[model samples]
Target: MPWVFLVIAGLLEVVWASLMKESHGFTRFWPSLGTLVFMAGSFGLLAVAMRTLPLGTAYTIWTGIGAVGAFLVGILWLGEPAGALRLLAALLIVSGLVLMKLTSGH
Candidate 1:
């Protein structure tokens, strides 16, 4: 389904983003190559999902998913801050995405 593809693409966005950070401006060979491949795949899948899903709704979900995923990864793996405010913001992003999906007449 298009939604499945979109979710996968959103997850891939998270993967590529994490890999990109590890790539060290392309100085790290393996992570850089992985980043390039995953980035292209992520966008390709997003484009495919867009064929059936409304662009605005899909994009909002995609971005929301990416933001939350990245923040979680930063907190868990990268030693980034995990304060109450950060968690609240992440929750808000997820809530907004849910609201969009619930309200959209898909």
Candidate 2:
């Protein structure tokens, strides 16, 4: 399903983002290569999902998932700040994504 591909793409966003950090400005060979591969795959999946899913809704969900997932990864793995404001912002993005999904009826 398109939604499935979108979810996979979103997860790949998280993967690529984490790998990017490890890439160190593309100086690290392995992580940089991994990041490139994942980024391409993520976009490929997004393109596939767009075939069936509404562009606006699918893009919103994909971006929302990626943003929240990346933020959590930063906080948990990289010791980035996870303050109340950040948590609330992440929750709002999730809420918006859920609302979009609910309204889309798919």
Off by over 4 Å in 1: none
Off by over 4 Å in 2: none
What is the TM-score (0 to 1) of candidate 1?
A: 0.96
RMSD of 1: 0.8
lDDT of 1 by residue, 10-99 (tens): 999999999999999999999999998988988998999889888899999988888899898999999999999889989999999999
lDDT of 2 by residue, 1-106 (tens): 8999999999999999999999999999999999999999999999999988889988998888889999999999999999999999999999999999999867
**How far off is residue 12 in model 2, in Å?**
0.3
RMSD per model, one decimal = 0.8, 0.9
- Provide the global lDDT of candidate 2 against the true structure: 0.93
Name the lDDT value of residue 3 in candidate 2: 90
